[model samples]
Target: MKLSLKVNGKKIEKEVDDNTLLVSFIRENLNLTGTHVGCDTSQCGSCVVHVNGKSVKSCAMFAVDANGSEVTTIEGLEKDGKLHPVQESFKKHHGLQCGYCTPGMVMSSIDLLKSHKNPTEEEIRKGLEGNICRCTGYQNIVASVKGAIGKV
Candidate 1:
């Protein structure tokens, strides 16, 4: 299959298997390893990425399905050598521990903030329900989201 898409603001065209998972294509074909594949079953949000400005679990979708779409991995969140505001907030608030889930958490949090400009703790919790963080217990994650309320 010929896969062509804009990844991290760069146009990309490559030949990949028709059944290649989006995560695999991103990490293997594109060498964007920031989108981790924690679980192939899609239960883990570690493979989350923004497809055409919406967060989607890359493991659940095929690369061919993403053809012609704009994909943003965790690597794309940084611009001009600076981290995204949500990423900066996460770092400032100590929202990560093992770091395995930070990419997904950050991506999902960005989407959450887009929908809820000023989300309450409960709303943030609900928004991040799809993403599981085993280390933080969500106290700091919520704080990070709160910290990035208006910065997104």
Candidate 2:
């Protein structure tokens, strides 16, 4: 299949198998390894990426399905060599420990904040339901999201 899309603000056109998962295409074909594939079952949000401005699990979708769409991986969040506000907030609040789930958590949190401008603690918790973080006990993660409430 011929896959064409804009990834991380760059035009990409490649020949990939029809069964190629979006995560695989991003990591292997595009060499954007930031979007991790924790679980192929899609239970883990580690493969989350923004497709046309909305967060979607790259592992669950096919690269061909993403053709012509604008895909933003964790690598795309930065601009001018500076971290995104959410990424900065995560660092300031110590939202990550193992760093395995930070990319997905940050991406999901961005979408959450986009929908709920000022989410409460419970709302923040609910918003992060799918993205699992084995470390940090979620206290600092929630704080990070709160810290990015208006900044995002």
Candidate 3:
């Protein structure tokens, strides 16, 4: 299948297999390895990316399904020389440990903050239901989200 889409503000078009997952295309074809694949079964949100401004698991979607859409991976989250607010917040709050799930956590938190500029602690926890961080215990992750609430 031939797929065409905008990725990280760049236009992308390539031929791919019908079964090629979005994560594979991003990491293999585009060479954006920041989006990790922790659990291919979609149990872990490690492969999360933004599809048309919404958070979606790259492992759960096919490359063909992303055709004509705009996709944003963790590598795309930065602008020029500055890190995205979510990334900065995570760093400042120590939201990551092993760093395997940091990309998805940032992506999902961006979406959560978009909808709720001032989300409460409970709301932040609930919004992160899809993402799992094995090392942080979620306290710092929640603080990271709270810190980035108005910045995003």
Model 1 residue 93 lDDT score: 98
Please write out the lDDT profile of model 1 over residues 41-126, one tens digit for every residue. 88879899999999999999999999999999999998899999999999999999999999999999999999999898899999
> Ranking under lDDT, best-scoring first?
3, 1, 2
Off by over 4 Å in 1: none
The C-alpha local distance difference test score for the whole of candidate 3 amounts to: 0.95
lDDT (Cα, tens digit) per residue for candidate 3, span 29-76: 999999999989998899999999999999999999999999999999
Q: Estimate each model's TM-score.
A: 0.98, 0.98, 0.98
Winner of 2 and 3 under lDDT:
3
Candidate 2 TM-score over all chains jointly: 0.98
Better of 1 and 3 by lDDT: 3
